[model samples]
Target: MSGNSSRRSPVERFFRMSLYVFAGLVLLQLSLALLAEIWPWLLGIGIIAGGISITVWWLRHRNTW
Candidate 1:
């Protein structure tokens, strides 16, 4: 049981890290959107890039998390 729990700890850590990364990406995209009035293209690019990054992260970590 102890060994199993130890193995699970890494998965939990990875999950927590991914969550933080996702949150940061969201904030960045929101900031870009807010600045879109000056550079209208940035909001669209940020949304697309953020979506792709989150999708890739989810795919890579889905099994572990």
Candidate 2:
């Protein structure tokens, strides 16, 4: 039989929610990064790209939490 089949506690749930939130933020940052390539009204692709790079790090780590 398996030895790790129990429900999560409240703290675990909190962590799970936070992880998803961070991941979502990362996706938003990524969208902003790509938006510059499609839209010409903006002039900050470099900044958005930098932001996406950093957020991607958080996204990968959050997936583990």
Candidate 3:
């Protein structure tokens, strides 16, 4: 309402981008999990990748990396 240009600040842009990436990763996990359900070996790999993604996200936010 203040007639501002509504530009995103650097932190806001980073947050938005990270959120989108996190959502995309989750979607990918779902797809891979489904495939893994059909072929069991992929289950372990998919889970490991998911864990790594979460760990990386935690590290990023913790250290602003």
By the TM-score metric, which is better: model 1 or model 2?
A: 2
TM-score, each model? 0.45, 0.50, 0.50
Clashes of 1: 0
For model 3, what is the error of residue 15's alpha carbon versus the real structure, in angstroms, after optimal superposition? 0.4
Tens digit of per-residue lDDT, candidate 2, span 1-65: 46565777899999999999999999999998898676764546767888999899989999999
Itemize residue pairs with steric clashes in candidate 2: none
lDDT of every predicted structure (CA atoms): 0.86, 0.86, 0.89
Weakest 10 consecutive residues of candidate 3 by summed lDDT: 1-10
Question: By lDDT, is 2 or 3 better?
Answer: 3
Give model 1 RMSD, 1 decimal.
19.2
**Model 1 per-residue lDDT tens digits across residues 1-44:** 57675565777889999999999999999988777766757677
